[model samples]
Target: MTEEEPRLSAREMIERLDSSLSPGRRVRAVAALLAGLAGAVFVAALWWTEPGPLPGRTHLAFALFTVFCLAWSGYGGWLLTRRVPLFATDRVIAAWIGLAASLTTTTVLAVVAAQRDTGLGGTLLVGGLFAGMALVLAVRARTRRAALLRRVRELTGQEDR
Candidate 1:
């Protein structure tokens, strides 16, 4: 469309003024590619490090890392397909941060279990602390996400969905 043509959407206007038509798509595609490649490399590292040998603390650490990479890869794939707008990326980022925090806590606990004896009291304490923090973060993220959606609706001149 030419400059004289009226763009009906924020996306279209942005694309017209800017150089890219699908900026969000581009960002998501890059993330997906990088995450997928990282996942594959981590899987390979898992095989190389363990090699079906005796499982040790170090192997457990590597396994945790591999799982993290795979999870991120899947997340990236979901993001890529979701087609989130630039303004909405903040909400997505907030959600991802919360998810990463919880995943880290879980992975750390798993690694700890792999390293030493599984103690109920100690595990429960640490788990409870992190779980509470995760809950707080999740609630905050939801608030931010709602605010972001409201802002998007305002910009788009659309009714609340």
Candidate 2:
């Protein structure tokens, strides 16, 4: 008689499926968390410590910037707390969120530069760089997710849709 292989428990199966955390990823996450938190605090401090009264629009801009940084920090915190891996899905979401924030901040900064008769070209150039980087990250995340999905399908002997 042929012997059947032992079945794995749910926890064992999950452990096998989930990828281990890499040092690079851990550093990136922690860096993001620290940078975001620091940026938020710095912006808030600037807004509070301004000597003269600022315009209402300026206040709104500062608030928006602070919130953006907070959002990034919150995302980092969430990533750190995730014990169950969502594969590259979390990365895809993070990239999209980063893209949105980059676009918004870039536009705001460009507008401010133009209003202040500063270097609009330089601002746009830097902003474009950041936006491009975010786009690249999003694309990479999506590609990774797709590849993982394909691997899973192949392993399961399922037909690709």
Number of the predicted model whose lDDT against the real structure is largest: 2
lDDT of 1 by residue, 24-131 (tens): 765765685587667769676666865466557556656656666666666565555653344445345645654675656566776577567687467667777776
* Top-TM-score candidate index: 2
On the 0 to 100 scale, the lDDT of residue 49 in model 2 is 99
* TM-scores of the models, in the order given: 0.47, 0.78
Deviation in Å, model 1, residue 75 alpha carbon = 5.5
Flag regions of model 1 displaced more than 4 Å: 1-48, 51-65, 73-84, 88-118
User: Whole-model lDDT, candidate 2?
Assistant: 0.85
Task: Report the C-alpha displacement of residue 11, candidate 2, in angstroms.
Answer: 12
Per-candidate RMSD, Å: 6.4, 3.4
RMSD of 1: 6.4
- Give the range of the ten consecutive residues with the poorest summed lDDT in model 1: 12-21
